[model samples]
Target: MPGKDAHNDTPRRVLDANFPDLALPAAVAARLPALVHCRRLASGRSLFVPGHRPTAFYAVAAGEIEARFTGLDGTVSVIEHVGAPRLFGLAAFAAGQPTEYEAVARGASEVLVIGREAYVLLMDEMPGFARALLAEFARRHDGTLRLLQAARHQSAAERFVLALAQLARERGRAAGDGWLEVTATQAELARLAHLSRQTANELLASAEAAGRVRRGRGHWLWRGDRE
Candidate 1:
């Protein structure tokens, strides 16, 4: 279970760090401190499950959240790993629909949640907030299209490489000269690339041989100069 923190006041720096996608004006920003609350989640705890109606928008303040989809047969697939400073559940929340996937904390995490009423108020009164939200939606739309195109036309190895590249760009940290470390297990990479674990392993071996990637225990170091 997620626990609400007693100290729920959202600071300006925290807001700037977590909601970088939203370019809120000073007026809109002034209102957020009162509208947002913080919740802490233990690893493997669910923030929200499928068919649940979203009452708030969430931005990861720390750690990661895994968005997963469960099929009729109960096979679960990882849809996305929403990491710190990223927003999740926006599509369902904005559309007033029940969430189709479960959002679970991947590690001990904290999130800043803005209730629906507050979101609506901002949307209605703040042009900057509305515009920023629309812009983020458009950006996600383009990213989804690219992923679909890659899945349709790219080879398995190509798809795997692309997935790694995307993760490295989005979630990786500088691991010294010319190397970027991405905190992801091979299973997570396989799921993200829509490849079997064995296939991902084989591709990774090949990439390792070619001096493209170095797999660590729970992460991968990508050569920044490599494609």
Candidate 2:
């Protein structure tokens, strides 16, 4: 079976198809030094929180970021896991709204922070670059909606299977014998699947009994044959 480290090796083909060769324009890239900056985050550090005014656009340069929404009752739901070379937090910039989710680093990570003024300037002067990013935004938005719908309509076991497959695609890598692996705590999996922790645990145990999965330290193995 693969391990936690293998999760970082997964190819984001779904997003990558639309986001192929994404890059800032030369002029915009050059101006980034003045209008944008980079930061390194230790694992568990928050990049932004709900209700924060959008000051800048963010892109992950390395490592993973977990996006989560917290309800009025303080219940937290995992929205998605974003990996390196991907943009996030664009909703606030595009709509001029306060952020609705908290984005946290999943591990040691680096991010590009582009200031609002520069972001607008680039959009005006670099329409191609802007269009590319908009496509990514659209794709992410649709995916999020689908995940939410799945959470609302699917059974607990079905939701867990769906979430497991998604995470595997986004963050896992293949092991021998048609297995995939990812490094995620059961709590994180529960949040991602929108299931209670006990429900996730029970479902996973059933999966294991059915020979569809195997649990490991800080990670889980999924049988590709099953999903």
TM-score, per-candidate, Cα-based: 0.80, 0.73
> Which window of 10 residues has the lowest lDDT sum in candidate 1?
1-10
Best by lDDT: 1
> Stretches of candidate 1 above 4 Å error?
1-11, 18-30, 121-127, 145-154, 175-179, 223-225
Give the alpha carbon lDDT tens digit for every residue of 146-178 in model 1: 655676798898778767876785688998878
Q: Which clashing pairs does model 2 show?
A: none
Candidate topping TM-score? 1
Q: Against the hidden true structure, what lDDT does model 2 obtain?
A: 0.76
Candidate 2: how large is its RMSD?
6.7
- Alpha carbon lDDT of each predicted model: 0.78, 0.76
Give the Cα error of residue 92 in candidate 1, in Å.
Answer: 1.1
Collision count for each candidate, in order:
0, 0
